[model samples]
Target: MSLDEVRDEARAFLSDHFPKWRKENNARGDLDFEQQRSWQRYLYEHGWGVPTWPIAYGGRGLGMLESMVWNAEKVSAGAHTFFNLVGLGLAGPTIIARGSDDQKARYLPALARGDEVWCQLFSEPSAGSDLGNITTRAERIDGGWVVNGQKVWSSGAAESDRGMLVARYDTSLPKQQGLVYLLADMHAPGVDVRPLRQIDGGAHFSEVFFTDVQIADDDLVGGPGDGWSVAMTTLTNERMSLGGGFGTFAMSFDEVVDIARRTGRIDRYGLVDIYARRTILDVLNNRVQSKLFAGQIPEAEGSVIKLLMAELGTLTADVAIDALGAGGMLAAEAPSAQQRFLGSHAMHIGGGTDEIQRNAIAERVLGLPREPRPDKEVPFKDQLRS
Candidate 1:
């Protein structure tokens, strides 16, 4: 079958099966681990999952166009793609690009099959936007290295079995030069995870502490002092994944049109706002969509899509509230409009804050001057922090 045919088939299968598959409890809290494993196994058996990965890496050896179509169909079907979201979305691509042969053999299959859950361990208490300024120290030890420090705002770390961590190793080297990326054991004796409840009331992210955590040589993803470059690989993948079709939920502006027509709000001032939204939507479907087909290499512009989606999310939730008036918040037992309101805030904050993304686009994509940072050259130990 052609790629379109394959996508239609997947959509039809999902349309018939998704509702029954998504039991109420399954949607209550990020699909349970058992359900995730089962769902991944189903995808694996069906020649899906890891579509763009090499055949040798346990992927379907499918081309990017086919993979993109599959992702669009999957989202349209409302199929839960949360299983190994971070693992496959960010970590897997990084490993494929920069990891050693052994690393690929050990991690890629597990990541593809959902056997291993991965979290990003890049942000720190004092190093959110300025991640290169992280104070998490990894001292060289006899056999390998010993890590000591903390990482915060890590998504899914509480349930993650492993993490892709970036840390500073040698004080003598330049700040960006002495950094390294490694696979950290989440269950190691020195690793501690504490959930951070957000304004939305979900404990989806966590702060992780590593004290005297010993990492063997094999655990290091790239060579010592190459963390920045290795991190760029992951960062680029993260942006690509963000801009990738699957990353954007299929909640299009057409739905807003439907809601406005239903509520007779199409003639109001709010309708102008909706029109602006439709304009943004058109740019996405026309400009960005065509750019992808033209084979333009991706960049932090992926974050532009993410930022647009976040804005749309907020607008959508607000429109729902204004349309339903007093009744919007009443559906407590079912999936209510309030849930969307609660959830939209995270879209801007998670996956690198909107501010950080703008900075990246300005510096990397537009060739704007780099942001001033006096601490860029300072050693982790020498830097003073509150």
Candidate 2:
């Protein structure tokens, strides 16, 4: 379908089905877990969920433009797309791009259908931005590998049935090379998950501990020693998804401008400047989306979007706090803006740290001199830090 036609259909769908949830619970137009699951079921049944994937993978096989249109309309109507986020955006894409045929058949349908929720087990207490430094170990045993380690900041772990995890399989090799990727059942005997309470009183972030967790051989993804590259694929999808489809969500640059206008900050606080920057940011966003529509994997461009969005989010929250003044105390009416001000730090920490993203942008995008790693040749076991 043409872009205009797709937009029209999406608008119609939003008008017909989107729920106008309360601001306190529906920031970014997001739904609660149960609400998100039901909404995803409808989208999945109608071939709207995971629309970018092919029909065989339980998607509508829509073009990128159409998918963007659909997302924008949904967000505008306060529709939530939360339930299948990790499954659909991170795990499903990685599996589609890197999983074997059997693996694809096993995971994609359930993920797209929202029958199962998934989380990522990539970060550890010691390896947040420097993921290659993780110490989670998975040793080969009689039938499979025995994993023992702790993973931190895992989103949706409490409810996830499975997770895409990376573990060190061969410490003899370099840390990056010795890794293995596996799909782990969250309910397995040795798996322990504990949610970390956030400043906002939300417990979505979890820390997962594996005590001799046994992963069957069939759960392995990609070839032996291919985990790092496979992980890069997932990370790429993650970085892209983190930024968004544009002009969507309950809070955005547009909302920032709206708030500024409403509070009369537009006259004094350079709201026009924010609007101008948002215009340019939109152009940059569109450029990335155009490349994506052509089937190009946005490598450095993903980091650019991530960094921009991080800055934009902070700017909006800061402006909100400033503009709201006494009104900031009214959490019910301005929940999104108020909460945004309180939790602005997460944007920089989640996905990847802001500093790390800047380094990526500097070296990767601008072609600057790569930072020297003295430990590049060190074996995982021989490395001073475990």
Candidate 3:
């Protein structure tokens, strides 16, 4: 369908369904768990959920442009998208790109329909940006694999049904080559999830522990030793999603302008600086989106955009906080200027650190020589011993 047609249809559907759902749940704020599931199911049944996914996977098989139109309409109608963000944005896309047919059949349908929530079990205490340094081990077992290790900084792990995990499977190989990616059941016998309280007092991030947790061979996402490549796909999608403004508390330029006006700081030079940066951010985001629409993966571009986004978020929040004077110290609810300032800190840390992104941009985009690593050719087991 044409963009106009897609927009009209999306607006009409949201108009008819969203208000009813809101009224029924009396949801003046965010939806509860059950309400989120119900809303997802409602959208899936009507062919709006995961609209960019293939029809066999519970979507309308729409293109990126159409999906953007649908989402724009949702924003206009004050309707939220699917609550299972990791499932739809990160895990689902990775599985489609590298998973076996059986894996796709088993996981994608429920994920797209929001019957299951998913999380990424990639980061660990010792390895956040350096993912290949993770020490989570997966050993070959009788009927499957037995996992024993810990994952930290997993968002929504406490509520996830499954997780996309990367573990060390062959210590004799190089660190990046010895890994395996798998789908882990969060409800498995030895799996534990502990929510980590944030500065905002929200437990959106969690620590996941796997102690002799058994995963069937069928849950393997790709061939053994292909974990690094599979993980790259997931991480690339993650960076793109975050850079696209999926999981951020970023304020628009207009919102910043309004805050400045409200606090009598409209004439501040910071406003001009923020306006210039916001314009640059919009251009970068548009370039990334255009690449995606053209069926290209913007790996280095993703890093650049993510880096810019993090900087922009922090700058915007800082300006707002300064504008608010002492009022910023008095905490309001979330998305308030004060809360946003605090939350913006996470943007620099999540997806990938700003330093990591800068390194990626330097190496991948600017064609710079990589930083020398003594462990580059070392075996994983030897590196661990060192």
User: How many backbone clashes does every candidate have?
Assistant: 0, 0, 0
Residue 17 Cα positional deviation in candidate 2, in Å, after optimal superposition: 4.7
How high is the lDDT of residue 115 in model 1? 84
Q: Please write out the lDDT profile of model 1 over residues 79-108, one tens digit for every residue.
A: 656777789888988888888999899888
lDDT of 2 by residue, 1-386 (tens): 89898889878776765543233335344456776776777777766778889888888788766787787787777674556578888999899999989999999988887889999999999888889998999999977899999999999899999999999999889879999999999999999999999886678799999999999888899876998999999988887676557452225666776777788755355455556656767787788889888888777777777767766667777776677777777877588888777677788788888788889888987889989997767898888874
Can you give the TM-score per candidate against the true fold? 0.85, 0.90, 0.94
Sort by lDDT, top down from the best: 3, 2, 1
* Candidate 3 overall lDDT versus native: 0.84
Q: How many pairs in model 2 have backbone atoms within 3 A of each other, for residues 3 or more apart or on separate chains, i.e. clashes?
A: 0
**What is each predicted model's overall lDDT from 0 to 1?**
0.76, 0.81, 0.84
Q: Candidate 2 overall Cα lDDT vs. reference? A: 0.81
The stretch of ten residues in a row with the least summed lDDT in candidate 3 is 240-249
Worst 10 residues of 1 by lDDT: 247-256
